[model samples]
Target chain A: MKARVTVTLKNGVLDPQGKAIEGSLGSLGFEGVEGIRQGKVFDLELADRSEAQAKADIEAMCEQLLANTVIENYSIELL
Target chain B: MKARVTVTLKNGVLDPQGKAIEGSLGSLGFEGVEGIRQGKVFDLELADRSEAQAKADIEAMCEQLLANTVIENYSIELL
Candidate 1:
């Protein structure tokens, strides 16, 4: 199975990297850009497993390593 | 309008960071993990525009600033 995980900063959390990207976009003349938030995407290939098992495993992976749960939120999708 | 852009490394490209993550997963006792690739996601808000215009503007942004076309591939999604 293939899985994708996206980790994003939680609401009320500050994102310095996103701010930097917004500033750069302004400098680059992308005038319409109002705000930008950045996040991470991880694509993982795993040994074949049932959909339910894959999802469970991926959730564990996020909780353990893929995300810092206190400040970030992570979503896992199985494909 | 809201837009989401994902930047991913092209296939066949080396990804040492991903390899490191995979090794760490094994250390974490997640033996099913076979391979992993890391990518980036950007969530942006823009001034109201027609969908066509928004799409065009985002395409330009990707080509000019969001992606390194030589080794990365980017996909833009309007929401």
Candidate 2:
């Protein structure tokens, strides 16, 4: 089985990296970009696990390590 | 208009950050996770631009700023 986890900064969190990228884009002549918020995606290969099991495992992973729950939100998709 | 950009490390690229997260997950008692590959997602709000124009602008952003073509791939979706 394959799983994808997307982790994103919560609203009101500052994204310095995204801001930097936006600035770089402006310098490169790309116009009309007002802002950028960057997040993370994790792709995983699982070994014969059921979708429910995988989702549970991934949720645990997110809470434990993949994301800082205080400042980030995560969602998992089984593929 | 709104746009989403997902950036991922190319296959065969080393991801130390992902490895670190996997390790942390294991220590936190999440089992059966073999590997984790991390990527980035960017959400942008555009100022009333056509989809084609936004896609073009985002492509330029990816090439010039959002992704390192040498080691990453990026896809843009207009929403």
The TM-score each candidate achieves on chain A is 0.95, 0.96
Q: Say which candidate scores most in lDDT.
A: 1
DockQ of each: 0.91, 0.78
What does the TM-score come to for chain B in model 1?
Answer: 0.97
Candidate 1 chain B minimal-lDDT segment of 10 residues:
B57-66
Tens-digit lDDT track for model 2 on B1-79?
A: 7888989999999999988877887788777778888898998877787778778877877887778999999988888
Model 1 alpha-carbon miss at residue A53, Å:
0.7
Best candidate (score: DockQ): 1
Fraction of the true interface contacts (Cα pairs closer than 8 Å across chains) found in each model: 0.90, 0.85
Q: Which residue pairs does candidate 2 place in steric collision? A: none
Task: Assess each prediction's global lDDT (C-alpha) against the native.
Answer: 0.92, 0.85
For candidate 1, write residues B1-79 as lDDT tens digits.
Answer: 8999999999999999999999999999997889999999999999999999999988988898889999999998988
What residue pairs clash in candidate 1, if any at all? Answer: none
Error of 1 at B68 (Å): 0.8
